[model samples]
Target: MKLLLRRPQQSDIQALHQFFFHVIQDTYAKEGIAELVDDQQHEWELKKKYVAMDLESRGEKRFFWLAVDEESNKIIGTIECGEANEIIQQTIKEDLSYCPEIGTVFVHPDYQNRGIATLLVQKILTTLEKQKKSSFCLDSGYKQAQIIWQKKFGQPDFILEHFWGTNNHHMIWKRALPFQL
Candidate 1:
């Protein structure tokens, strides 16, 4: 499917929230496992909070990029970077060079394994480079995301095992800005 990487607008708010609640749930909440203490309600709130954060981040400062299906003209996925991740700052041992992190990334379940997420990520990465970000980081606990980052970005520098006091663990993957190379 053809995809267009576009900056989000207020018009996309409703659809974005719906996609986050349903499609994103399958990606984030694993069967019988979660740092949300396996609490469905907690996960619901957390997801809403992230969506709020995305909505609040429009035009400058934090950037949010969404991928739209050209044929369907619907938002299939989103990748966001912001300057407010205390966990990543602490985990990476230092704040990035004015660059914060890849915060919330989501793709619809039906769109999984379709290379859509990769395209979304690459689009955001390219946009971040143009914005002069010198470093990048993203957090992952779910198995699929952890694996994806490992393959796309190489090994993580930090892993907090049993981070949620179970099989759950926090993983942080980092990358330097291309201009820094």
Candidate 2:
């Protein structure tokens, strides 16, 4: 499939919401947390509101990019930049103090392991580098995402054991922006 990454537009709101819900629901199901599906749906709705607010602000406070499958004209992935969440800020403390965050990364389940996410990360890193940012922080509460982040960035700088529940931890990573992608 031909993939294209571009800034999100007003018209893409509904599709973006569906994309987020689909990915989140699939992830929880795969993790055997189908019982949390309703919670995930609620979170997605809140996230949609946040994205809409960001869009209305014209990206002054946040920026997002969507990966589209050119053949089907559908959104398959997304990445965004913004301030670190409260959990990350509290855990990373002085290390990530005021650093901008790179997050909201998700790819359609069908497209996993196909380098779409890597492309999104590289694109965000390149964008940050161009803006003269020296580093950024990312946090994950999902085990699958934490594993992927560990492989890409080494062990997290901070870990909150059993943050969500027993055996479900949250991790925060701080990395210097590479000069070259």
Candidate 3:
């Protein structure tokens, strides 16, 4: 399908919100964490907040990009870079509040494995480099996503063993500027 990658518009808010839930539910189910309704809701709320921050500050606080199907004009995927999340700060035991984080990378279930996420990430990295940002951090608690991130980013800089209990762990990666896609 033909896709147009661009900054989110005010009109795209509702569609984006729906897209977030669709992707989140699919991800939680795929990861076998479907029973964690509270986690899903928390994630949804965090994404919604990010979108609001992007809209209110016009990308000053957080920059977001949406992948829209050119024919359907639907938000099929999303990615953003902004201030480091609170959890990341707490985990790292340091204030990385000023650090830009690459987060909320999501793609519609129908669009997975099609390089949509990679394209969005490449765009964000390019934009960050243009903004003179030197480095960025990203974390993933989902095993599926951790595999993908490991492939693209090598080993994570930090691994919170059993962060999600049992075999489930959280991985965080920090990459410097001028990274190869």
Candidate 4:
């Protein structure tokens, strides 16, 4: 399917919110953390706010990139570059004083494993490079995402043992910018 990658628009807020809810719900269910489902709406609202802020600011501090299916005109994936979250900053011990993070990388479950995420990441990296960034950090706490990141980025620079729970950890990877996908 043809995909279009572009900055988020005002009209895409609801769609992005829905995507965030479902993806997070699915992740929680898959990880057997069904209790976290109750937190999905709160997280979605925060993400929606962030998206709205990004749209208004026009990448002044944070930028969001959305991948839309050209055939159906539906948002299929997204990625963003912004100041790193506190958890990530503390884990990586950098505080994002200078290094922004590439995050919020998500793809619809039906469209995953189809290179949508890879495309979104590549687009975000290109945008960061264009902004003169030389490197970025990526973090993940989900098992499935951790596997994919390990494959794509090799070993992480920081691994928080049991950060989420016993046997569930968070990892952070730092990559030099302007590199190929």
Error of 1 at 141 (Å): 1.1
Give the per-residue lDDT of model 3 (tens digit) for 1-181.
8999999989998998899999999999999999999999999998999999999999999999999899988888999999987767777776565468999899999989999999999999999999988888999999999999999999998999998999999998888887997
Q: Candidate 4 has which clashing residue pairs, if any? A: none
**TM-score: model 1 vs. ground truth:** 0.83
- Residue-level lDDT of model 1, residues 1-181, one tens digit each, is 8888888787887887787667545754554443444564565565556656666755455567888989999888887777646677777676475766786678877787898778777777787888877777788877778888888888887898998568878898777776221
Best by TM-score: 3
Alpha-carbon runs more than 4 Å astray in model 4 = none
Least accurate 10 contiguous residues by lDDT in model 1: 28-37
- State the lDDT of candidate 2 residue by residue for 1-181, as single tens digits: 8999998899998899999999988888877787986789786986686677679877656778789999999999998887777887787667553477888798999999999999999998987877777899889888889989988889998989999899999899888877343
lDDT per residue (tens digit) for residues 27-131 in model 4: 778878868755666767767777877988888777998999999999989888888888877776654655778888888889999999998888887888888
Largest lDDT belongs to which candidate?
3
**lDDT against the true structure, each candidate:** 0.73, 0.84, 0.91, 0.84
Q: Model 3 misses residue 83 by how many Å?
A: 0.7
Question: lDDT-based ranking, best first?
Answer: 3, 2, 4, 1
| Ten contiguous residues with the weakest lDDT in model 3 | 90-99
Name model 1 segments beyond 4 Å from true. Answer: 28-31, 34-57, 179-181
Clashing pairs in 1: none
* Count of clashing residue pairs in every prediction: 0, 0, 0, 0
How displaced is residue 116 in candidate 3, in Å?
Answer: 0.6
Off by over 4 Å in 2: 95-98, 179-181
